[model samples]
Target: MQSVVPSPEGLAWAQRLVRLDTVSEHSNLELIETIADHLRTLGVPLRLTRDESGRKANLFATLGAPRPGGVILSGHTDTVPWDGQVWSEDPLSGSVHDGRLWGRGSADMKGFIGLVVARTRAWLEADLPLPLHYAFSYDEEVGCFGVRHLIADLKDAGIAPAACIVGEPTQMLPALAHKGVHRWRCCVKGRAAHSSLAPRAVNAIEAAARLVTVVADMGERWRREGPFQHGFDVPHSTAAVGVIAGGIADNIVPADCRFNYEFRELPGSDAQAMQAEVRAAAAALEPAMQAVDPATGFAFEPICSIPAFSADADEPAVRLARRLAGGGETTLVAFGTEAGLFQRAGISTVVCGPGSIAQAHQADEYVTLEQLARCEAFLDGLRRPAAAC
Candidate 1:
């Protein structure tokens, strides 16, 4: 069968969006303005709300009536850092090569967002039966932060959606489930002393090392005996310390040390319980350190926490997604997305979009022309009237 193609205008919009540099650290104001301006030109009504820091913002727009329920097409506006990756092209400069678009956010998200926004315009032009809502958020790369406020606004306004589609690069398949993530930074403080009298000093790095070991052991136990029934490839919640820093030299007892740990919790896993186990282990180590120096202590602070989401394979949203994507079987993923937060807010949500997760957050990230074409067709199907029973 000959395949359908995306609208030329929509493709242009996607390329333009990919060109913007909205890395997680930088403000997404430029992207927001671009979206808002595009919506205005398309005659779609929009509202822009800035976070308190004024560093980021969220854009919400709707077509058709503000009814009790509608479909929300959502995507995050931030991209991960590309600081050290060796890329064939500039990560910020969206370049097209071999029928693929390469850039930082092209696959991880902006590609999906572009398709949705472009389709929204097509929907407006086509006068679809159901309302389509557009929701673009910032800081999703940092843990789904921007969408929280947008969800709150929707709730306060008594707005509800029949279903939500979070386009998080699912290779254009219907993703029914994904794991949650909890990130933390643990800091240990101890007394420093001369190398000649190391026994008199409480080494922060040493304390951090003990904590890391405890976390590793906990991960092993979880893998062996904890809840591991999920269908994911790993089939269990996993934990790891990604980064650690301490000590200036081998001779000196380090006064302060910090490490970042992350937990990928399987669906239904109690994230707090896992974190408590790690905290208890750190606490147990504190007294020994304080024995050498009374001021010694440890602290754990949240970096970010993104909850898990799963939709029943039989759910209407999943069924619709499968149908729209031409009947691929539903699947689960191990990575987290903003879909969980949407589900937590009582919205029936599913993850289905263009591009592959494997290509996300990598050097020369790109989405194939085939994925983009499939996604445009999916959106076109959504705009079609539901068939009568």
Candidate 2:
């Protein structure tokens, strides 16, 4: 589907947003306050949840009477960083060019947040019975961190929304299923020796490489296995080492090496069991290494884990998205989102928003004006008195 430039109102709001840097590494308070100030004018009740470090926050605001079964308009406030990428202008340009709004977070989803906020003003005067809740979160690029805190606080307050819509970049399709993202860090400790005496020394990098091989083998095995869901492009689970660092000059046998790997598992597979298998592989290598030097072994540390998400195709959230967008088909996205966390909290949820995932995390990232128009229309539909919240 070709994308035309978005409407001026939505484009203006999105441009203002992208100018602010809310990269996961940086604080999202600036962007949160920007929205909060405008929301305050609407006279809605607001609940703000901050992380322990006080660097990020989640803003949950309600526009009508706070009653049971209100609908949630959810989008993350954080964005991935653009450090060394080449761009036609500033990373935060937010310029309208080539029939798209160009900026770092324009597609991954600051644009959707802007559109929802802009449409909210009109709804304030609507006589709809159900409340509309706006949920903006932080650190979503880094393992869905901030929303976890927000969910905990919600649990404490005993507040649960009737349903939720995660504005991930899925081109406004209702995404019903996605894989779990589980990551772990493995560190190898070995003895150091000169290159000439390498035969007597334990090689941490070599040992780490062996485990990398195991991870690749596991990924291949999954590709050939059963329990696959046909809708997903890659129907089976997947595993691979994403990052690794170790080794010194060739003259030295590395004494320490560490690598991080993750597996995106299908609903039927046990992620913990997959991790345990990798740990066992490391354990098998431990005995041989420790024999050379008692201190030479490996250690495993968990980094982060986000569970796979799935929902009934006929659920209210799915049906609402389909109805609002004039489509009932549900898609399975390749990337992860906070929908799983919302589902864990017992609020039915689905991922749907404007823009394509292909534009996310790349230089000159953009969302078409046409996509924003569709999203604004979708958000506007929620204001209908008869639309199921």
Candidate 3:
């Protein structure tokens, strides 16, 4: 396909958003409020669904008449931190160079958000057959927390969109399926003692290491076994421990150890079953631990969960997205997105947007002007009423 010049207003909006730092650890209210203020100027009615702290929020707005069966264009406001990444220029510069707009969220999602907002004027002026809704969420880079509140609020208000398009760096291609994300933290409690007397005292790090071995075994089993789904980069489900912390000194037996682990499972895989296996392994270890001390055992805490998503091939939303994206074959992704949550809420959904996932969360993250132009064309196509939608 030939490259097209991206909309000047859209590029400006993308740059404006990329300039703002809405890293996952920080509150995204500044970015949310910025977009809210712009929407207010367009006379669009919107609601702010704020988290309990009131520092972060999700913005849900309608561009046409207030009614059900609207089409939702969704994007997350928060981004992963660029702390350790080495970049030649400022990560938040939002600079336009080499036919690309560069910044922290230029590819991860803010590019799609900005372009969507830039098209508000045209969407507002057109006699749209159906409403166009904007659902900008926060904390997606962490675990897709903000969209839950937004969806609940929509339920309370009885606002149901006919379909949803999650702009999650799919390179302008519509995605039909993706893996689920489930994370947990395990804490082992033992009795501290001198390293020389470790035989009498329970060793937390050692016990935790045993459990970690079990986790690793389970992952290896899955890797070597069946239950694979084609199309995903890792067709089989995967498990891995990410963070671990324990002993302060090698001369002492540490009483506490904690580790975080996650499972990325296929759509039909039972994540709970996988978790149960780990819990059972922990239980088997508890007897040996309790023999040493009554207080010794394992505690599991859930960290985050995002369900797997698989859209029906004949669904109106899938058809609409593929058509808007210029009739490309639908694909599957290994990454998790809010698409599953939206689908669970009974809204036909697909993941489709500008940019490449490879550039997301990387140094000098960027979205090519050509990709943005293609996204703009896709959105323009969406503006025209179609029965498929």
Candidate 4:
């Protein structure tokens, strides 16, 4: 089969996708349906999974007839919100300028999705011995949320691919391991009272501040304590509080406050244990608040849990990814992706894709045409029998 490069044609396809504005907050059905219809026309086997309301959808299409072993090319259809970003061109322009595809989803993933779509015809015509599965998902920007159900569906259907390649921006390099991302929301309930009666009032903001301090302290400990993995840029499990909210007047003691925090743990480390530690610290603070009033306490809500992913360099998925993408030392990335969920589902998985993560989810986000060209070559490589590994 001739090479199918991700060029102006592929960029055009990506622009059409970016134009849809499938931000995680909005429904991704539009993007998924369009892709599903295209795949249907190619005579591919399709599985469409949706949320209870049918607002979001995950399209799992098989280019060739399903069989025991094969490779899965996976990407998320949703992009991060760009409500406040300033750009020289329309964010959805998919404009080709200075050798780059300028668009919101170009770097993060839609670029790879476009490349895969561009080569769907080639893949269908070739029909390599090993099957190929395109697992494009939704709400990946929020968390590895939709892919969880998608993987469950695949399991229930007994459609187990031998390996999966998640198209998360990695400059077309193969990422062998990445940290797990765990996020949670904590609420502090306290007694409101006039500022003059400080002794009687249980300050939720103050209590929440203490809890955030605990999170910071734990983060510091991880930085100093050993369990360090050298490959990761941070080289340690990390934690941070991203959002906090509460109260009205400064004169009144805040009755309630909530904060969101997350921990990105190194592979083989216990993020759950660290989360428990934060909860325990919050519990200790509650006793003081409860002393003012029995109703004063703290509550916790889980946002998401994405396990860390690590594959031995010699793993079949990693080997095939390196070979297809051109050999280089496999690296670990700090960001999270659905690859972790895929790995947890018993499918060997690797992270390999176009563009640079630095360009993702920010103003002027774009994927260089050079990178897309490399990705196209990788997709073309899959058409060969050697990609069966």
Candidate maximizing lDDT: 3
- The lDDT of each candidate is 0.85, 0.88, 0.92, 0.88
Candidate 2: tens digits of C-alpha lDDT, residues 312-373: 98888888888988776678998889999999899999999999999999998999888988
Question: By summed lDDT, which 10 consecutive residues of candidate 3 come out lowest?
Answer: 380-389
Give lDDT tens digits, candidate 3, residues 1-389: 66576889999999999999999889898899999999999899999999998889999999887766978999999999988889989999999999899999999898999999999999888877789899999999899999999999999999999999999998898999999999999999999999999988999999999999998998898889948999888889999999999998988999999999999989999999999999999999999899989999999999999999999888978988988898868788889999999999999999999999999989989999999999999998866877335
Candidate 1 per-residue lDDT, tens place, 6-30, comes to 5677677788898898998899999
Q: In model 3, which runs have C-alpha deviations exceeding 4 angstroms?
A: 1-3
TM-score for each of the candidates? 0.96, 0.97, 0.98, 0.97
Candidate 4, residues 70-141, lDDT tens digits: the string is 999999998998887888888878777787888899888999998888788887889686998989998888
Which residue pairs clash in candidate 4? none
What's model 4's lDDT at 112? 92
What value of lDDT does candidate 1 attain over all alpha carbons?
A: 0.85
- How many clashes does the backbone of model 1 have? 0
Task: Summing lDDT over every window of 10 consecutive residues in candidate 2, give the lowest-scoring window.
Answer: 1-10
Q: Cα deviation of 380 in candidate 3 (Å)?
A: 0.4
Query: What does the lDDT read for residue 345 in candidate 3?
Result: 98
Q: Report the CA-based lDDT of candidate 2 relative to the real structure.
A: 0.88
